[model samples]
Target: MPSTPLFSTYRQGENRVTSSMLAVFERVGLSVTETILARASGESTLETVVFTNQHSTGKGTVPDARIAADFTYLFEVKTARNAIQDPEQLTGHLQLLDEESGKKTSKRFLFVLTPDPVRPQIVEDLADMRVVWFNFAALHDAITEVLGDALSAPSERDRFLLRELQALFEAEGLISHDDVVVVAAGIAHAEYLENSAYICQPDRFFRPGLTHLGFYAGGAIQPQIARIHTLESRVLFTYAEADLRKTQGRNKARIGEVIRWALDTEVREEGEEYMVFLLSGPEDADTVRLSAPLVNDKVASSGRPWAWTMSQGYTSLVALTRPGVSRTSDLKQA
Candidate 1:
């Protein structure tokens, strides 16, 4: 027989991990509803939520439940280091839920508190079992979306709980603080763009070594915070269809054309180099690609380039970065 997996061993011997998982669910429910406290009268709040771990049934196996009502969810919480050894495990839980409820209504979900993305095969296997996978980052995104602009409200207790949750997520390698801030700023920026008469695109791209953050309205690479300064900066390059003399030089114009086209359309290529054009706007009113190194160099060479003034509308950026200095502020000071 094969050796048991580490997760199985941990589950059999330890209750603390299970307790923590339950706490995560509880905190998520609380944080999601914290904003409702500020809602106007007559505005409805979320339904009374409940999270129960290791719910008991008359049968040998028990499934997690909501509010101790009939089993409505089967939750398998995994720590950062553990991989799903048996995808069929969820199927067993599903069977147990069916046996207990006599009708199929319960949902199965796997909560991975890891920073890394789950393996595609594992995801597929879970899907086969009718199980939804909610990674830590996805959970954070859901919570943030639920809170909306109410995040700006001065609720220190709520903020502390959120920070603590984020700390746990970070320790498990779910996300970095910088990533959280950037995402928050991006959400705020997207809202700002929508309110400012710009059609913000839903597509965004971010990965290591990418020179730009992600695309926004008109395929603009909107950086949340600048590593160099808060002031806006611009780099201009003109492309003419007639200027195709040098074959090597034609690449720049080709790139420029792609950027222009991406603004009007969607570009979904992966990797670093192509991401620049993949997230740029049209040539007429081009969007700036906020590169820290380039911005720093511009600042060092000259006292705030004249083109910097062309970049504006950082209201969301300012709101997100307040109470703490960010790259945007750093660049402004520089």
Candidate 2:
């Protein structure tokens, strides 16, 4: 059997991604569009835009009025972080938006979308308030949340098109699905139980696409897997004692105490560098514990416990949370 592709094969990567996104927005109708725009721009102007599709007598009618936007939203899509660094492209787009936005009280936005977690330094330094920078992850989240709403009553066609867009995003490496990385808790097990954070060497890297962190202790994997925490206003920094004390305020002294206990050292070096992973549980809680622990049942033929040598492992959320998954080996990936 033969089938037609949802998006064009010969188009450029950015163009294809952009087209898929626009097609989904158009097909899903006005609510999704207004919700996304409200979230991206943090503006309430979408509420003021009146939409009607009925007769003068308030009876059901065909297209009494068409949905429209009072403002303009120009999207500049880039496949890679480096591609969006070209100042000329942004300047040209902003100039055109400005020309089209003349003598209007309504707002105009030039939304720059990229695959990077953060916008490029050029976009960050832009003085124009009309410019907004966002990543594909945010778009994915917004779309998923909107479609998952039961009250919104999304149609089957809407679901199919949006799912296709998500598939495209995953294929292009624009987003990563949730996965778990289980590592040895060691001395930091206590820290996890209390403060809900894990610290490791700065050079150590986890497997790609991991969104949650799990701990292995006492010949078993811990009950809970925590979602990695993020701060919108904070920049990345190393976990140095001096820096943490100076910048972390309130939690500084407590963090130092915990670090001392974890390291089991008397004199702490000021130059030590570690990457801190803050953890958040359900409802943004400080701690999380599962009903039961996941144990390692891989044993020798003689019925004695085998030598466990799991430093770290990766598993999907579906496998980890399944009811019959009792052994650590069942969830751990090679």
Candidate 3:
């Protein structure tokens, strides 16, 4: 991937893609392998015996390259979106290692690291190869070398088990707000965004209207009938790149939500649109109102303010406003 100066997804000066994220993936792989090998075989010392550009390590096994068998047990690592559903991909990599790794070692293992839990497909695939799949557990586990803290491990309620996370990453600056955003955004943009689940997160409260339905959720339910807290947590966001957009209000909370969801500067993919309602930004604060683009077309179906993209030649409706209303470009799917 080359750099595009016009594209905001990739920074102008930096590489087209962020290698730090790739490094994090590699780090996770190394940590998981170390932890698993340590726990299963009582082997702790590990090294990168193979390296490559496309493939992690080629199928060459150890001719002059294979590590000492007594010390190094060949680990076939497969990092996927989720191990459960995408088992064949995991098995495919293991099959390559099994035939290629010439030490002809027994007790060979296949490890699958997934963004989410391993699916049934992964479990079934591992059973056939006599290889076991250790999923989120390995990533969540403390390797005692890399992290030295247990930040990856889940907390029992409100408490985070940092002591254990320290043992795993061992690297400084491993976790932060930017880290979470990068990770989450990466997952959303990768192999799964095309899937429907990433586009919408509609709870009982949110009810998006189909084009024909005109926008109504039958009727609102009473709180007494059902009270669901943290509805945002339940949403599995899956949006089409084209349909994805963001709207921010003058209120910080509203803008924060929009920025969090719509910020295109991320690892996964860039968002479609981000509209902010600025109340005060070295400008007027009293009668701040929606300003439509001067060049408007009444013939357009949206009947909204439209701006033409010179690059694409697509006239995008920038915003829509009525007499005294500011129509937000917010996600109707909530």
Candidate 4:
């Protein structure tokens, strides 16, 4: 399926794009105030505010900033899917600012905000100027870092706005911060297991929630409580080796069959590793307890072994856990 664009149709205009840029700057720890919007195609408040000391020039230019007693930023916003049309326009704006300010002590930044990534040549052309190129992904990262605390808080309003911004960022083909957290957590968990599990979604472009996890085991596994510990987080769960034959006879053949099929296919593929988590419950249940096996030497050494495949390629396992429910077998029936 084609992925959804990060920006909506209504927000594709230059003005709306510019407003979004300002919102990001303000939200991302920048002391932005005393703002002005462009009234027409050529008339912008940026030029007026920053060029107060110089004579009027009919050329339309946007100043990166000129917040009184604060800072000056000149921003040019482009929502195009292609490269910038005219690089000289940005340079011209900078020249205009230089003429007006004439070596003033104010800090100036030329910002180019675009939905699409720019070419290397574009960066080279603006190398001498105070230009900073920000595509949607880069900008999203900045906003996420700045608002990390607010995004994690329980405030409904803050979360709502954060989601809106995240949606916008995702629409522009950028991964949301929420997905990043989940993936990062999953990676840390995988690493802590001594590389027993492999992360599925390593690419930042794909969205992998917390449930997308896979593991590797060498032999028959036994039921045990395993804690997936990462640098910053930990998740504890009871793992048990699944009995496919028993599951097949219980009208849960589809899931069992899939797991069996994946195990069989994964073993045949050279150097391929895959794992499966069986989630069994009512379709509408709020939570379901998951059970998977912890493969260890003790379980492998046991003579009466439960045959589970080893090696890995690609597989996904997901099981739901109910609050206050500890045992996997204690999962409530649908």
Give the winner by lDDT.
2
The runs of at least 3 residues in candidate 4 whose Cα sits more than 4 Å from the true structure, single-residue gaps closed, are 1-14, 23-29, 32-68, 117-120, 149-160, 172-334
For 1-334, candidate 1 gives per-residue lDDT tens digits of 2232211224331233445444544544543533332131112322234477777877897886646233344456565323566757666876766665664444332332333333324556455444445455555554454445664552555556555655555554444322211222334344333321112222333333222222222223244332211111221222332134235354344445443443334332222122122222222122332332122122335575333222222222222333333333353442
Question: Whose lDDT is higher: candidate 1's or candidate 3's?
Answer: 1
Each model's lDDT? 0.37, 0.66, 0.30, 0.39
TM-score of each prediction: 0.35, 0.50, 0.27, 0.35
Q: Model 1 Cα displacement at 97 (Å)?
A: 3.1
Q: Write the per-residue lDDT of candidate 4 for residues 1-334, one digit (tens) a residue.
A: 2233323345456655556545543543222122212111112333323324443345776454443443466777765544466778888878866765655565565666665422334656677546656555555544444345453342455445545765665665433222111122222332323322322312223233332232333331222212222211111111111243344453233333433443454422323332323321222121121354433332245565433333222221211122333322232210
- Candidate order (lDDT): 2, 4, 1, 3
- Tell me the deviation in Å of residue 5 in model 3: 24
Off by over 4 Å in 2: 1-6, 40-48, 51-68, 177-334
**In candidate 3, what are the lDDT values of residues 200-297, reduced to their tens digit?**
23232222210000011112100010111111323222244223323322233433443445434342234333322212221222112234312222
Question: Which RMSD values do the candidates have, in order?
Answer: 14.3, 9.5, 22.6, 18.6
The ten-residue window of minimal lDDT in model 4 covers: 231-240
Per-residue accuracy of model 2 over 184-296 as CA lDDT, tens digit each: 87765666666666776665767655567788888887787787653112223324553465556545544554455445543223456566666764335423345677887
Stretches > 4 Å off in candidate 3 = 1-33, 36-67, 70-87, 144-334
Q: Score candidate 1 by lDDT.
A: 0.37
Maximum-TM-score candidate: 2
